[model samples]
Target: MDETVTAVIDDVVARAAAHDADEPDRLRRWRVLEPDAGRLLWFLVQSSGARDVVEIGTSHGVSTLWLADAVRSTGGHLSSVDADPDVQDAALANLVRAGLDAHVTFGTGDGGAALAGLDEQSVDLLFLDAERTEYPGWWPHPVRVLRPGGVLVVDNAFSHADEVAPLAALIDEHPGLTSTTVAVGKGELLALRSR
Candidate 1:
């Protein structure tokens, strides 16, 4: 990331933190990804040379910005999904401010619907940071769309353990996936599909 991008990310992170603090209801807040996790996403996209990236949650676009920035360098693209149009708008504005909007496509709808529409085994990286409870219902799509050797990253693994455990366990036990948990921001359950 360049100085300009770094500045933009810092600004967004500050704004999101304030927004989240002011919102009493957790659902109403913009739960931005931690900087370290965002950087990890950026590095993964670039190092893997991922040409197709999908992000399930785009709160304030902090994670989207990081992904898009990485894809910009790799000549790839990022598709970000969020159910809330207003949140997606905020994310889009942030992306535009960072000059990374061109690298992303926004989808405002049910994440499962968005995932179902993707071609089988077409995605290189799938990041899940949406509602934990809904992950189980969306399980089939993620498993179907991720190519062999593709990565699946689930956020809030440790933070919201009970809510995400079912999906995490499924991934961990799946015959086609090799999975592990990492103590990053909120914890991340990472998996790679068998080739």
Candidate 2:
């Protein structure tokens, strides 16, 4: 990340932190990914050399920016999905400000629908940070869309353990993937499809 991009990210993180702190209702908060988690996303994309990446949520685009930068580094592309058009707009603006808008494609509507629209075994990396309860129902899509050797990352594993438990269990039991948890930021649950 360049100094300019770093500055933009720092601004976004600070603003999001303030928003989260000021908002009394959890549902109304920005709920941006922690900076550590953002760095993890960047690392995963660079290390895996992921070319076609999908992100299930775009809240203010903190995670999206991190993923977009990584894709920019790899000369890849990121497809980001968010149910709320307004939030997606905010994310888009952030990406543009960071000069990373060119690296991303925004999908506004149901995250499941967006995932369903993708071709089978096409994506190199899939990141899930949307509504937790919906994850179990979105299964097989993640299973189907990820190419062999693809990566799956779900955020808030430890912070929202109960909410993400069922999906975690599903991933754990999948015969074709190996899974583990990383205690970063909100805690990330990572899995890789067998090559």
**Candidate 1 — which residues are off by over 4 angstroms?**
none
Tens digit of lDDT per residue, candidate 1, span 12-59? 889888888889999998899989888888888888899899999988
RMSD of 1: 0.9
Q: Pairing residues by index, what is the TM-score of model 1?
A: 0.97
Model 1, global lDDT: 0.90
Off by over 4 Å in 2: none
Q: Report the lDDT tens digits of candidate 2 across residue range 60-169.
A: 99999999999999999999998888888998899889999999999888888888889999999999999999999888798789999999999999999999999999
Clashes of each: 0, 0
Quote each prediction's TM-score: 0.97, 0.97
In terms of lDDT, model 2 sits at: 0.92
State the lDDT at 31 in candidate 2: 88
Top model by lDDT, which number? 2
